[model samples]
Target: MGLSAFQMVYWKACHLPVEMKHKALWALKFLNFDPHETQTKRRNQLLELEEMQLHAYDSSRSYKEKVKLYHDRKLVKIVFNLRQQVLLFNSRLKLFPRKLKSKWLGPFGIKRVFPNGAVELENPNDDGQQQSWVVNGERLKHYLGGEVERFSKVMMLVDP
Candidate 1:
């Protein structure tokens, strides 16, 4: 038969009376403790810990929002249109690069512009590969110069 008590007690210490008596006698001393009071103290401590966790979470969320707002404010909004010429920034040059080497890759023509800041560029040199590739608008800058002939003109120095 199972026994129920108003307060929690270890079954080995209370249910088996013979063993408990033997242990108590061997110890030569017994101390009184209130189980209900111990449980209440633990419950109160748990409630306090939960409240502290909730407060920490709220503070962390507000801090993240503030950081995001600051970052958004600092970001520049880049705009591009179809058929516009632009230079692509080369970001993969990592080794001991030459100081005079140009970092910009292309004067590629814009084929299409997406609403989400992605721009499709047209390949001017027909390499028989993919005609277009999509790149982030932030990596492109406006090309201002006009088309110049690749052949160089030799001028004779004349003295009269």
Candidate 2:
């Protein structure tokens, strides 16, 4: 005579008397008991739960990767060549500044371009003053001036 799984669990939880524990084994003998089948069913259920958890984790990771790719695609690429004039975004400007003030501060000429995204800027008005700044390309944009259109010479006769 052997104890059924449920009786064994109850006996372990309550710490029943030795005589009471022995009586449950007599009841188990009256009913057919299969320990191998019960253990196999529990193992199968654990494997199923583990597989479901792994699938959920994979789906969550893939969704995050797709969202990141979408955001990356929407970003505009900014590149500055040598001698190109561009406006720099002034991030340090106060929240309540003058109404007439502009946040973008420079029409500075790009004196030199570095491979690692650093640019050397020179003010055309100042003869010898130049500043070297290591900044991301996102903080700059191309500057179009009316001086280029106004100063261009129109020649009627061409010498080929």
Candidate 3:
């Protein structure tokens, strides 16, 4: 069984230091956490962030928002021996929608990039075959959400 949203809220309230627990509770509510199930979402998001764009939006309006929300009284700090890195972006999470939870997924096990302009990825699944792909630098940029010129220029420098 997974941790109920209510149980998570209670746990936060019960164990966290007095002032900060409230903040932690707020974050939990915002994220719709179901403790055990919650792990998978963060795990996937971390995987996605590794090579994709990530933005952590602030609650306030601005030309740019990064880590902008401030809930001074309640901040929860728990550390994980995480295998993946997390990036955060704020988007609509409702449909009954919910706010886009703040977190990015990855560092998706990148094994190598070859001098000859091949981008290699460790098998993304349990497929068990190391993937060595040969492609143009232009495609690499697209796969990585960057400009073709950017990858091409870097490719030149890395070669010689």
Candidate 4:
């Protein structure tokens, strides 16, 4: 008995050599093309592809959400109030290679609080001039050190 069209296609996919060219006319006469069955198979394949795509999207979204949650849990909320003393972290000092010196710059006072973790700092100098600058709040830590008392006394001696 001659092979059917379904068997011929299956044999070709499996790398089996079938002599179809010699019996090409006979194969065409026996070829049964059911349009309804072909359409049903195509629809099933499309549905499977859509389902796989949906699964991939769901997996990626869930992974992103898990990553976000992990990072959020590690976040430390730093709050600064006006006139509060804090030390500014000096990131540039690492390049100079000074191990003994402190990396934190100043016992700067908070002048203004801006939105999104930004704070304006008042310069630590005891001079009359007060300089202020804006910096990220993450680089600052609370200052708990002692306060220095400035003496304005001036004594003069005269010969009697």
Candidate 5:
């Protein structure tokens, strides 16, 4: 039993963070994938997915296929949204919302500012964000502390 299709999905699902787990947990609802199948079967399903012509994959029986087909077709624009949301859970900045506010509120004076500090706002692209960008504040470096290589207490943005 190398790996059942559902098992493979289960394995991946196990590694998935909360959002993806939610998506994978009830995967059968939105997508036609079985999170508890064998790998060989899953691989076969992926082959069938190749025939769906990307856009039409939603009509397929496996959500896994839709994801794979979308990847195969380079239809990043369509599949990225949900996948990106799932990926966000795995980001290091999971503490912050999709958007954030930054300030030199730390005790440090000012050394140098990171690229993100310069933009008004930039998307962290937590996951599959195709157009990830960041929003930064101007003159943020002026408030940095000299000994501070990094500061965790900077102003952060949160989703309402």
Candidate 6:
């Protein structure tokens, strides 16, 4: 009978009857057992599992970086220089506004440019009072005021 190291140790620890103790020791002597081989196999398996986890993490990180680059490319680059006149978007205006109301608020002049995309705007009506505000570049656009033809409503006389 072949006995493993653990089985042999367990038999030794337990107080077996006198007749069975000799037979158990004799069986253990003929068995081929290597504890170091079992330990090395377990260590190798753990190392392989760790390598697989690292590879999965790297692949996920690279995919996220690619998506970020794609989104960053779609963003519009609108930069304004100092003293440039730009119209501010009236975001506060509601969907149902007054009939003759315009969506844009200003032809505000850019007073200064911050390191970020924010610009300090100055009112054109220089009333000796310096009232300026910093706003994001996305809220402003270049003012294009030109001779636009206005369309007037014409009533037609129809006989029923």
Give each prediction's root-mean-square deviation over alpha carbons: 14.1, 13.4, 29.5, 13.7, 25.6, 14.5
Per-candidate Cα lDDT values, in order, are 0.70, 0.66, 0.39, 0.72, 0.40, 0.70
On TM-score, the leading prediction is: 1
The TM-score values for the models, in the order shown, are 0.64, 0.58, 0.18, 0.60, 0.14, 0.53
Query: Can you write out model 3's per-residue Cα lDDT over 39-117, one digit (the tens) per residue?
Result: 9988988888863543333223343333344553355532222122211111222223435432222223334555654
Candidate 1 residue-wise lDDT, 8-39, digit = tens: 45455244788877777666545454557768
Clashing pairs in 6: none
The candidate that achieves the highest lDDT relative to the unseen native structure: 4
Q: How displaced is residue 143 in candidate 1, in Å?
A: 2.7
| Model with the higher TM-score, candidate 1 or 2 | 1
Provide the lDDT at 59 for model 6: 97
Candidate 5 lDDT, tens digit per residue, 1-160?
6776777776742333877777666866667655566567988888878866675665665878778888889733222111112111112354554454332222222222244433322233336332322323332233222432233322333222
- Winner on TM-score between 2 and 6 is 2
The ten-residue window of minimal lDDT in model 1 covers 151-160
Model 3: lowest-lDDT 10 consecutive positions? 84-93
Clashing residue pairs in candidate 4 (N, C-alpha, C atoms within 3 angstroms): none
Which candidate do you rate higher for TM-score, 3 or 6?
6
Model 6 TM-score on a 0 to 1 scale: 0.53
